[model samples]
Target: MVTQTPAWVLNDQQGIESLQLADNPVSTPKDDEVLVKVHAASLNYRDIVIAKGEPQLPFFTPGVTPCSDGSGTVTAVGSKVKSFKAGDRVCTHLVSGLSSSSAPTFTDINSGLGQHLDGTLRKHAIFHESALVPMPPSLSFLEACTLTCSGLTAWNALFGLDGLVPGEGTTVLVQGTGGVSIAALQFAIAAGSTVIATTSTEAKAERLRSLGAHHVINYRTSRDWGDVAKSLTHGRGVDIVVDVGGLSTLPQSFKAVRTNGLIAVTGLLGHAEDQAAVPTILECLINACTARGILLGTRDQFHAMNRFIEDKGIKPVVDEEVFDFLEAKEAYRYLEQQKHFSKVCIQLE
Candidate 1:
């Protein structure tokens, strides 16, 4: 008997309204590919933007499966594949396992799954061997799903700095309670850095603190969170700032970072409208700080980050809600609200 996979698909060129769950046949893996029976997939702001008419790749259409990060068991592998076999639990790297640059950050996303190629909002997905990372035994599929995109972005932002050592009293500022920032807090704190986290809601501040954030600032109430950050750092400013909250927050991030500090810019959910902040960013750079733009990360980096997580037993910060594959759209909606604390996951059979 043939199996069918139900996937949340965006079939129109306009908006999220066009997204629908459709039952499609499962695919066969190519010679260098393996089929993952995706167990849990997570949502990001990118999915929301892409669902609302932003093309994943240039000249790409609207109707593709939508989400990059997922964890699953290997159900099948092609003849040429040797690293994995049936029943192996795994997650895919953010890219298609291809390298475009040598820098720790700024790797080109050429054939991204979920954006241009088909993604893991379905029961199964076929990807290259290099895309797969072995899941740590300590993580459930739900927890493992968080690592691919959010975890990697946070890891790259904090640990990817050139001259910065892991320990030795470094301070890092993370904005918002979104997946990446939350993960950044966990990672930085674990690595012996002082973590300052910001949230719009006072209620979430406690949660952030609980997640190892040394200090929590309510961005809505505090007009100058940067000053608070500076004060926390004894007026020296933090060593790194995970500037996920784009242009609106970059100025504050500029003020928050120490001289020669690194500001790793990831998400622009807050700057979707005005992307041209280069002049202001340059001013910040001239002040003896480095601002690095980040996409997800390479497969090699993903492995290295996973190794750290495994060795440290650092679990991901997951929210209370878990949706099944059929309810992926609902999960995406909740992620957009930014009400949830950590990663939002969809469980696929």
Candidate 2:
């Protein structure tokens, strides 16, 4: 067993450039925890935010390791551990001990792996048994690591609330080719729902089609792409709109959904701008759709999503570029530039 491991730490500077690779002590797991030999860790938008020390996160522990989503093999288990043994493959849940059905509170958010607590950027990490779920059978460590955040959030958006399961004859509209949107597209198609995706370029549009999207809308060329999306659905509008662009795109999302349809507000990727002439809330009222915010998901949702991915042979889309563990800062910059197709990952070994 190794006594030390290489890990990336976000020093007091708080930015991609601030990440430092250091040799850190690796301790044995505690009575209720297991030590894992991490194989890969993946990036999410939130990881970047935390690395920069966002002021809103009052409880963020500075100089802590960063990254929430990871996949690893259990190397050792404490005496009290029972559900897992050495050599079992697992993926992390963002929060350390989340098992509740409700959305996370501020306290829960403070305990997130990459924020208030030490995260999985290290080559080895110790986690409570409840913080992990069995790895999906069909994916490699690189692909499985992404399920910890993006895949689970997409699942929660579509199936986590209101018992609304999208399947045959249902329609889902996903925004852009980011991690969560791409994940949602994959899950919806696997469950037999027709998907309409929006992207800026024809290149990404082709990729979306090849991934089983029924139609692709170029949001750049057509400012009113929402009307185009509705037209593709025969003026009936879509059943769900996975809205990642917050206020800048909410008006279009409202225009794209059917009456009482759902718009899952997954991210605020858009900048402040005059997107439309009307008030955003009025658009929701006019469209008669429910728009709610998403904050990743819970441990139980992570487990259920893993099972669904395994059962359907769905592998979350990972970017072609794989970074070495030492290149974590570069990975963060690449993701910040918004060039990757979906998830960006770094290998530990």
Candidate 3:
């Protein structure tokens, strides 16, 4: 008899409304694969973009599972899978086939999990053993799931090439209180760096301060929050800026960062119209700043970040609204509304 598990499948034509819960046969792992029984999964802005049929994303046939972040326990491991075994808690890495080289290029067509292949929105999924990382003991499955995407991107942004060596004197500017931003805030604080966080409301500003942000900017009230961010740094400017807002916020990132500071572009929250208005090359050149685009990250980096999280007792800020497996669509809807302070997750026990 074949084992089957329930999964949420995306129909390209109907969009999110077409995300139907159905049973899928559990496949036996290949020699290098591991079968994970998914316990929790989290939403990202990129998932919504893919559901809306973004042209730049890889084309998926209708019924593809759509989410890149998930955590689970291993149910079975292939004969060659020595790193993990049945009953070990683990999380899937977003990228699968990237070489473990120090200078690995992430621009390859197969760099994404949900984009190029079936993702983790299913009850049971098979992944190469190399793509699985042990979950940090400090995190629950829900919190661990949040790390696969948002957490890893934040890790790569702050620690990747041209990244910040966060310490007492180092300062970081996080664009908003979303998953990536909040993760960056926590990581930077743990590294002993002062953080300047941006938010749209006073309530959120206080929440950010409570999370160890030294200064919080209510960008809505202060339209020139960039200059204000610089001011908060005693006119020296922040050492690093996690620019999740894309084109709409890049100009300000340029203004807020000191000469030779690093700006890591990791999201596209800006409008399409603003794409054409991104700051000119002269602005970046004048600041002597370095801007680099970040994908999720390599499996090695994911493991390293997990170790850091475990060592620091870092907890991902999952929103209070928890959805069941059947309520996956509602989870997507909630993420679309963008009302949550941090990560939005679906529990699939």
Candidate 4:
């Protein structure tokens, strides 16, 4: 399905204040496409970069809608759309969806959803059947929307690469309470891995513990939080460290992950640090561990993650305040401000 939708156009790529929304039109699906009645859309750091015309990405289509992560119901399907049907629950994936074993290339991301193509931020959107995944049953549309990006990135970090899926006796280190970190914490716990999370406040630390983190370290107080995480593991170090803070936090993350362990570089939050300086290979070599940069996941991995979520009854954590469709700019701004605990979303009825 397709339509001339007056969606949330990223006008001029100036900033969040430029997001424009309209109900637009909903058309029937094409032979290989599926029409979706988008129920919800979530924001990611990449979305903000595109909306604000940040240099993180080399190309930005200014007129396109600015979000790739969404959850919706299939309203119609083309004759050739076999994987999805009318009334089925679904979510959007990067447009050029990858194979199960395929690693994403820079070109793939360059031509992906919310990048080269129009995104899934509208009330009604038509996507190629291959670019949609069945939503995890245990999650509502709001929660499912998050799985498109941050959730999938976390899943890929924990289980996707090198066949290192965290299980019993695995110790995971998560930094902050952002979407990726929180998702990693939840998925690790579900897989029976002990998790150690770092946050700024005791209040947030308590919330982390409530979410099943075995140890919560206040990074503000414990300046050497990497050593703290290592001590928590009795000097063996965590098996996996999901590092959201890039330049500022990588040193500690290096200290946290054990030798030959994995450090998933999912996000770079706070300030303009992510835009400028990044962790160097020298640091990784000195730390004696691999630091892998994650860029979401493939369609097959998305399905696998969804199955695990449904089987474990995992529900993504969304911010308490959800926005209406008209508040698209507000949602982007909220996520830009980094005030939310996990995901910030707009709900469309």
Which prediction has more favorable lDDT, 1 or 4? 4
Error of model 3, residue 123, in angstroms: 1.2
Model 2 lDDT tens row, 1-349: 7789888887764577778888888888888898999999999888877767666453567768888899999999888988899999999887766554556665776677888677889998888887788898778999989888788889989987775568999899999998899999999999999999999999999999999999998998989988999999899999889988886888788888999888898887776477455346666777777887788787777778888887898978999999998889899999999989989999987
Instruction: Write candidate 3's Cα lDDT for 1-349 as tens digits.
Output: 1389888888773457868888988888989999999999999887887787775454665677888899999989988888898899998777665564333344442355666667889989988876678999878999999998899889999998743567688999998889999999999999999999999989898889989999988888898899999999889999999999887788889889998898889887885445565787777788998888887777778878999998999999998899998998899899888888899999999
Off by over 4 Å in 3: 101-111, 272-277
Ranking by TM-score: 2, 3, 4, 1
Alpha carbon lDDT of residue 270, candidate 1?
63
lDDT of the structure predicted as candidate 3: 0.84
What TM-score, over all chains together, does every model reach? Answer: 0.92, 0.95, 0.94, 0.93
Error of 4 at 286 (Å): 3.2
Q: Which tens-of-lDDT digit does each residue in 100-128 have in candidate 4?
A: 55767667877878877778788788888
> Which model, 1 or 2, shows the larger TM-score?
2
Per candidate, the number of residue pairs that clash is: 0, 0, 0, 2
- As a whole number from 0 to 100, the lDDT of residue 7 in candidate 4 is 76
User: What do the candidate models score in CA lDDT, each in turn?
Assistant: 0.79, 0.85, 0.84, 0.84
TM-score: model 2 vs. ground truth: 0.95
**Candidate 1 lDDT over residue span 1-349, tens digit each:** 2267778787864555667888877768888899888889988777777776564333334567878889999989989988899999998776665652333333234356677777778887778887778987889999999988899888888777668744658888999988999888888888888888888887788888878888988988897898889889889989999998776788788888889888888977665335564336566657698888877766667777888888888999888998877777678788877768889988886
